[model samples]
Target: MTALPRRGFLTLAGALALGVTGCQLSDPRITGGPTAPPPRPTPTPVPDIPGLEAALRHESDLAALGKQALAAADRLQLGAGQRAALGWMSRDHGVHLTALLAPHPAERPTSPPTPGPRFTPRPEPTSSATLAAAARDGAIRDLTGRLDAALVDYRASARGSRGQMALLWGSLAAYARAAQVALVRDAPRPDPLVVPVRELEPWSDAEAEQQVLRQMHALVYGYQAAIPWFRRPESQTAYDLLVHWRDLRDRVTRLLRDRGQTAPAAEAAYALPVQPTDRNTAAELLWRMEAAFIPFAGAWLAAATEDESRRMAAEALEEAARLCLEWGGPMTTWPGWPG
Candidate 1:
């Protein structure tokens, strides 16, 4: 091969060097093509709302106390009935704990905070009546106080949260209220005239009316089942409940009409979960019926469009829950979100 002139050789060398530099610059890793971007510093998770943490901690503390109370009852060698009652109360606390610990989008730390020290139940009383009454009273007082505080936290959290979280907090507040009634074997007649404001999510008028209609249908069925047992003198409470149910049904019917929707017709009959042979059995059946109404009423309350309608629904819910307590239903942590 003939050697090129110096000028031409220099030009050729420069071109080769430029081409090599271009090739080096095009390496895939240098340009982040087909290579993962530098692992973005893993973002720190946002902390949970202050109210949420407080509620969880409270629930954990209650659960620990419940466990201690149940153990004390067992050690006291209480009667089967008494022990069973205590067990019911303890179970409510367990349920509260489960709800508090359940996975939430806002959850952080992956676990609940450590609960405070376990409560030590008072020693068994000398008198059986004293044990029954005092133990129940003490348990009720403790649960009701804690539950009320939890309600405050939940309500505050609900106000701060959006969408489903708000709904969850409101429902939990209602559950706490129902549990309070259940703890009191003799719940004083809730002020029949005092109506409460129901916390509702934003919904269309049609949606709200539909929910109200559904609740009315539930109350109608409950009334039908309970009215038959009103023959007994002891069924006065049941009679009162029937009248209240009718009032609620009428109110909902009017609400539907106002919204230009038709109220749903009640079924001709509903199958009773248990046959009633006596007044006590009848009360129990009614209690079950009323308990069933709570969630439906709560749904209505949650969806109600007008404040008046929401207030009525809330009152109806409280009435049904109170009646259930009168008839011997166990206190539960989630009355409106029944399994």
Candidate 2:
């Protein structure tokens, strides 16, 4: 099989379809991406095997919860969107479970089955009376809470995980967290994913972590460029975000240092995937910049076993999804993953 590019990210094509421009990984808009590393080599799979067994059990429990809730969906008085979310989480967990059932990627599912609809923005009922009246509302909320639980354990296990298993844990954690955000309140539900779930060859952990740092650099620059285009309130928001990302850039730089890797110097100007001609494009750039890093950030989460590193990666994953929506990006079932 062909090698995954340093930034193919599986969902790049789908993000472009949403009217956001796809990135050219080679573009060095800022701290130009490190010279292309050779094709991603076959990764050595050595994640925590015992943790894998534990994860498998936890995943089974999650799947059972989703299935039980979904089985009672019609009686739950859930709206179309709510029912869709219930189904989405159920489906996603099952998908994750099925993959885990296979001990190795060689036995992984080849065909991407139906994974239900991702959470979309559904105007939550404004009145408290209606919410309280719903008989099974608590159950639904509990099911969503399990997504959070999944994320927490996934990150914890990642510390002891290695290679492909670690990568799977990171990706599953992201999916659970994003789904919970959607079900709790409607986030922008993205369209069906266009990215194929191909074989599970993952990026080298260190490489994935470094790439996130570089992307953070590019985002800091993008956020700065976007600041001037918004009105006072939005302009301040953008400015604030610029500062946030700048700080995060430095944070990740320090993180890399702690990991025994020296970060590259920042570039003068990073490549702009979609230059902002007006307010809309500027906002578009901001969200896309945030959304772009999520895929590999999962890989970074997998590789980063240290508490600080794992926390950063997990927060980055969740924050990027929320920030994407904050900056006018669509909320999809898969929040961080573009597809």
Best by lDDT: 2
What's the TM-score of each model vs. the native?
0.59, 0.62
List the pairs of residues colliding in candidate 1.
Answer: none
lDDT of 1 by residue, 1-339 (tens): 222111000100000111222356656754536665566565444455446556656656555554555566645444444445445545544444444454442221122323323212212212211223236556557657776887788767755554445445655666566656554544332211112223333555556556555545655565556656667565565667667777777877787777688777665555565566666666666666666666555555555555576556556655665666667654433444323
Worst 10 residues of 2 by lDDT: 120-129
Q: Residue 151 of candidate 2: its Cα lDDT?
A: 72
lDDT of each: 0.52, 0.60
| Residue 37 C-alpha lDDT in model 2 | 67
- lDDT of each residue in 1-339, candidate 2, tens digit only: 221123343452111111335678788765567787668666444333455555555566666666666566667755655556656555555555555544352233423323223211212222221222245668667666666666777777655565545555556666666566555554434443445444433555566667877777777878888888889898998888888777878888877787798786666877776688789889888777766767656557656656677667767776776676566554333433323
- What ranges in model 2 sit over 4 Å off? 1-9, 12-48, 51-84, 105-140, 198-206, 225-241, 255-262, 270-284, 302-311, 325-339
